[model samples]
Target: MIHLVQIIQRFVRIPTGILAIMIYTLIVYLIYLAFTKYIPMLIHQTFDMIQSVIDFYEHQPKDADPVLQYIHNYIERNDFFEQLQNGASIALGYLQDIGKMAVAFAMSFILSFFFMIEKQKTILFSRLFLKSEFSWFFQDLYYFADKFVNTFGLVLEAQFIIALLNTLLTTIALAAFGFHQLLSLAIMIFILSLIPVAGVIISCIPLSFIAYSQGGIRDVVYILMTILVVHLIESYVLNPKLMSSKTDLPIFYTFVVLLVSERFFGVWGLIVGIPIFTFFLDVLKVKKIPNHSPREIDIL
Candidate 1:
């Protein structure tokens, strides 16, 4: 044990310790910079969407006036008055969800700050605090933490890039369809992209309802078809291709995990489920647990 301790100390001596500290500091600084630049952008995009929706309704032609006769005619022909009421309800719910999401995301960023800072201390303390027989186990735990961070970051970066691209494409499609409140739709897409699997569908509901109210059911169907095609491309082709470039998990596994998480946690589950699963898997590897993919779960 003394010889092993001596070897460990010799390997990780002052210079190596200094290098680790420098690397950790660099990472924390980069994270801070990223958070600073993006948080305001996200907030701006959200408010812009809400404002656009409000303005669209505010400026709608007043009823029964000849100059606005076309809108009244369309609205009556499609019986969109009732639909508009329903849409208002949906929009209100979406707005509330957006507010909640903003709060949750802010909290996550704050939590991550503490987690990142305490990580090195946790590593050191584990070694010092563990029994000699369990010292190697603690070292394995630290190594797993590093690997999980690397994996999680890589997945998040790649997924977010795909999400941004999809948002851009979808916004263009909405404009092509002549949908009002284009910016709002785009922002919704961007926010939904953070969620896995069902995010797109959930985000689409309010936008599609608004589209239906303004245009008609047929127009809504067309928009839905377009969005579905985009989602197909995203789920089957883009997601797998991007994820494969980084990790080897099968597409079925991702789908199954998303389903289970959604069943359990609703929207929140969809956002955090896979990351949590991966983190647990990494920990299981550290602890030498037998593992199964999400597919094998028997909900019955």
Candidate 2:
């Protein structure tokens, strides 16, 4: 058996490895394309909301506005109209950025497909460089690949379901509390949740501010608390219980990975960071990379 393994290893080379990498990259790009379908509409609605805010402030009833002197004063001092215009511009820019990424992702996916097909000969030849004993490695590797893809798809499906649930709950909560533009805000939150850490902070900030402006301090506090509790349950309870039924990570490292990814890679990093980290960690375990402690694997 050991001798057989040795022959297999010798045959492995760059072509096979590159092919594998390209395939994996194509899969990721496809996922990104799927995400893009929803983002543009969400962005359009968000921009519309900004326009509405601007109009609301601009057309304040002149006489009544004087009566509500506090509101008038605050709006004036804040330059709410100008802020609204700027907000609209920023929102539009964000939408365009998403469009650009979507296009790029599509192009990359196409390129990878062609590259894999054209390099078939090269891919076969590259495998010849591997250590002779490792021929069986590819068989073991492909077995794990099949299993990993299945498990990963399930995890993504679960997270999507939970995110949708959160969106529904938040929208209902906002509507029940009489938030005027609940639909737009709810949609934004739904889209943002897929982004991970930065998404959490970004979506929450707008929600909190909307609650403050449209309702009051009490409403804002209530909204914040509700979201906080929901997130806690989602992160601490639902994730471990449902998503990571077999294994889980410590909460501390989850936060650390989130923070590090958010800081370094912005929104995309935040969304994908944990999954990538887990993948590498798993690979380390498989390869028995020296001095690397094996982490308990989790589906994120």
Candidate 3:
């Protein structure tokens, strides 16, 4: 965001910190809009698709194809429509949590804004510990913290690019297949793509349902395949190259970090797991901190 702030600075002269926070607030606002709007669309599409299935099951001829009949019979026996209703209700319930997340995200940016504006004071005050008796401990702490920030910042930059690419590819694929509400879908994909492995799966489920409503099972299959291909490109081609250059970790290590972090820290872990692991590596002197980094703590 600070990089973006600098870019904007060329065209307009404004306080950098203020501009950065303005950008952050704008992003959060967009995310809030997505949570409010797209979620309802997802549920509505899902409900419509499920209702169509129920209608077909009800109105099908007595001599309908046996396999198809058997499938619809299974759906009925499982109380699938009722389950979908309950699921929709539960999904709606999550809107409260989404509100909380948006508030927290906004608050984090506010804190960051203050920190940016007070960077000199923050650094000087934080550096006072260098002369403390437990300076060794503080030094170690700063070492790890610097590594984490630098690596995390780089990964975030790369992730934004990856998310943008993923959104464009997914949108084009959906558009080619003649999907509807594509603007909403593209926004959701771009947001979810920031979340690593879990993001792909989370976005896929509702998207698949929406695709089903648009063009039945075949459309769902295409949507799944498109997501899979995009994810493969992100995980293998993009992430490995970017992360390996920045953190010196193999893709295997990255996956392990993600899995372990996800187990312990849930969703937040997927976002930070690689950075934390790289911090440990930097502490152990197994990974070298990149010379060009966004953090000032390293030299301090």
**Cα RMSD (angstroms) for every candidate in the order listed:** 10.5, 10.8, 4.5
For model 1, give the RMSD to the true fold. 10.5
* Candidate 1 per-residue lDDT over residues 11-115, each given as its tens digit: 776433444455556766887875798656766765666566556544665553452456546766888657867978988887798899879977875665454
Evaluate residue 216 in candidate 2 and report its C-alpha lDDT on the 0 to 100 scale. 57
Q: For model 3, how does the per-residue alpha-carbon lDDT over 1-300 read when each residue is reduced to its tens digit?
A: 556666687899987667767787797788788679977887676455556656766676787656557767888799987897897798677666577887998788778777767766777898789878999999888766666667666767777788888999999999899876676677778878876666898899879766755566788899999999999987779877765566456557767888999898766677767667766776677867674554443348
Candidates by TM-score, descending order: 3, 2, 1
Q: lDDT score of model 1? A: 0.64
Worst 10 residues of 1 by lDDT: 291-300
- Model 2: per-residue Cα lDDT over 1-300, one tens digit each: 112223444685445445446556767777777568655665676667676655655666665534345766798998877886797798778778788887997787667555444555544554563334775776566546644543444445556666787788778888888876565787677877765444566777888766755655778788888788768877787676656642255667767887887788765666666665565565656422122111111111
Q: Which has the greatest TM-score?
A: 3
Runs with alpha carbons beyond 4 Å of true place in candidate 1 = 1-138, 245-267, 282-300
Instruction: Pick the winner on lDDT between candidates 1 and 2.
Output: 1
Q: Relative to the unseen true structure, what is the C-alpha lDDT of residue 257 in candidate 1, on a scale of 0 to 100?
A: 85
